[model samples]
Target: MVFSWIRKKAADDQEKLKKGDELVIPNQFVCPISLDLMKDPVSLSSGITYDRDSIESWLDGGNFTCPVTNQVLRSFDQIPNHSLRKMIQDWGVANRSYGVDRIPTPKVPVSGIQVSELLFILEDSVESLNGRRCLELVQKVKKWGGESERNRLCVVANGAITVFSAAFDAFARDDSFETNANLLEEMLSNMNWMFPLSQLHSLDHHHTEAAQARLGSRDSLRCLVWLLKCGDLSAKKDSMIALKELVSSDQKHAEALAAIEEASEVLFRLVKDPVCPAITRSSLMVIFHLVSSPSSSTSMAIRSELVKMGLVSLLLELTVDSERSTSEAALGVFDMLCDCEEGKEEAYRNALTFPVLVKKILRVSELATQFSVSAIWKLGRHEKEREKVNIFLAEALQVGIFQKLVLLLQLGCGSVTKEKATELLKTMNPCRPELECVDSVDFKNLKRSF
Candidate 1:
């Protein structure tokens, strides 16, 4: 019935255009604001009709005047033009033969009241230990948040994160609840959507208390690690994403996450063997946060743990032929890891390390270049081990690092980068004359410069 568009009304209108292959839609059906056919047209006090979404968006930007008439709105009320909506639907049905489907009767947008009520239900269900109810509520929350940006704002602003955090803490504390994978999956799905919202920390005091309770408890964090290790692919993706958001710019939180028994290994495996783009990106971001600790001891501990998990080699493989952001992220973390001697030795062992760094200079991004140079400088420094230093700089020159550094100095760089490139050029400059002499002469005829 929905696809039934070979109707008499449309046939009458289209018959006149039989020879012409153009669609002659009536201008009345279009919204002035968007210049597109209105999906849900409503009338303002200015007596002008526009799409509900468009007008609401205009008003949300703090506008008071009507867009078409330029008249001051007496009231911000939107009267639904039900009759016009029906006409649009009928027209769409009649024109289905012309590549038009009937307009769907848009569901009433979720309201703050509706979200609050759902939170009420979420609270009640969790308190009763009602598994079936919790599952239903999780699906509902996911659907509501997934509907639109407006609905997402409503769900999160109305304290969804706090409620979910409290519920997670509760579930993690209850050993029996661990078996309820069905609810866990749904809950994780719902939380994944909410976690990326920037409004997470803007909740009320009540919400903050719940969030603290969850984070302060070791078991809740352990439960996340459990999900990372044991859950299915979807569950793992959601958990990884949640962990990334949870650790965003919070050194204390990231420290705790790294301290989890198997978290480092899990993160390492995720980077080494990616489940998908998102999983790998999130896992890298989570590690980046952990390695970025401000505390000296914690930073050392995290880097040491990552070395044990073989993160340096894993990141090297990820950097080559990866997407811009992931490559940048992997390189950034690897740059941080290179601060330690073990990380530098491990990365220095890879044949691709020097070439990859030189290849990415000015080719990727400033940060990638900065990170590449930092790592190179750190690995290339071998003052006591003079032979190792010579061999390392030989590899650097073989990979055309000499040209890249000169070009970098010419192209301009940060003050620190400029200083480093200048020194590298000066260091390699003296060697160039001697290397040219040795290359042009046979090995047997070559004599020691000393």
Candidate 2:
């Protein structure tokens, strides 16, 4: 029975492909420049559809033949868009208003199915839709725009990219890291169609309605999605900064804080975006910076979420870049954090990985010595921490640490008054037995040596 089903499925797939092939391929979908399927189609300022690929091929790669102009398109920029792209843009604008509030609940028309469904289907492969079909459907939905529809399309494209990312990760497990990377690059190239600025006047507009929603509404989910997926590191940082800047006015403080607190959950999700390349890593840094900043008007929800993630150590990691100012600032914050004993404990408890402060100290010995000396001075005399000091010292001594200790003692005593040094020396001397007798001359020489 399974074999028969497989045979039937193969026949159906081939039939569908034949039908797909029979349909007239539009010149609009095909780039005039590369004569390939459009990737990152841009409606240029001149109303022409051109992108990096066209620019490269037509100008630099000597494939300068233009279909419409019948002229050699010397520069990719030369394509005139006086009519073509403007119509698409105008159509998009007109369609956007029609479905602003059309929520795709379970009862909604299947024809009006949104991007989330596409994402869900792809994730489960439930409808047996392949990647090419999935992308085609997304593009189709994008071309037929409503505000809701466009958002849906954007999210679908995002979801498709994620699916590709997952596939790439799986491939990496089979030792195809290079191929996986190439696939990811291709996915990113295709995903450029969902640029936030292209769909709306600004990215903020995309989330404005959702931001206005009551806490935990589906609309809020829209805001969270962009925060997680859309923005680059610099972009995310700027967005957070913009939100924070608004908080000082107090007029929108509560609303902004609420939105950001909701955003924090998304930020947490973003930190785990799997691609830890520089750009994504930088985005994570921006999130940590926001969480660590005292100026941030983040809510309790966000704060608690950060605490759970051991935000302090994460912040420390962000500051590990070669930027001296950043490192010093991070250190200052760390010192302040040390003041909160309970918070420190909580931070350590929740840490994903230990900070390896000792190993780090060894790497940066001068900084480590500064910290260690200060800590030793503070804890060495403390009744509560003395045992810790003894344990630490014993371990150090085992590794021939007496030389370091002697050097430190000399350095520490250099600033001391002679009288104070003498007093310290007296305090440090081991007491002799009262009943023990020695030759007077030998005792005098021993005292001189001491």
| Candidate with maximal TM-score | 1
Clashes of each: 0, 2
lDDT of 2: 0.39
Every candidate's lDDT: 0.76, 0.39
Regions of model 1 farther than 4 Å from truth: 1-28, 44-48, 65-75, 175-177, 197-217, 382-387, 435-450
Clashes of 1: 0
Candidate 1 per-residue lDDT, tens place, 1-450, comes to: 332343445446655644566566667789999988788899999999999999999998999999989989999888888767777788778767777767998766688888899889988988987878877887887887777777887788788877877777667776554677668767778777776534575586666656655743666778788888888899898777767767883566787887778888888888888788988888888888888754567778889878867888878877888888898898989888987777877876778787788777767777788888877887767565667667777777776777777666766678898777777777777666444212111122322222
lDDT of 2 by residue, 1-450 (tens): 664564445434533433432532234545766775343455433345764346544544555454445565444444333343333333333334433222121112123245556556654541342445544544444443333443444454343434433432332243333333333233333334432322333335434323222222333223323434555554344333333322322323333444543455555554444334443343343443443443444533444555565655654564445344334333433433333333344433433212222222222334433433332232223345555534443343333333333433454423332233233224222322222222223112111111
Residue 302's lDDT in candidate 2 = 46
For model 1, name the residue pairs that clash. none
| lDDT, model 1 | 0.76
- Model 1 per-residue lDDT at 126: 86
Residue-level error in angstroms, candidate 2, position 302: 3.9
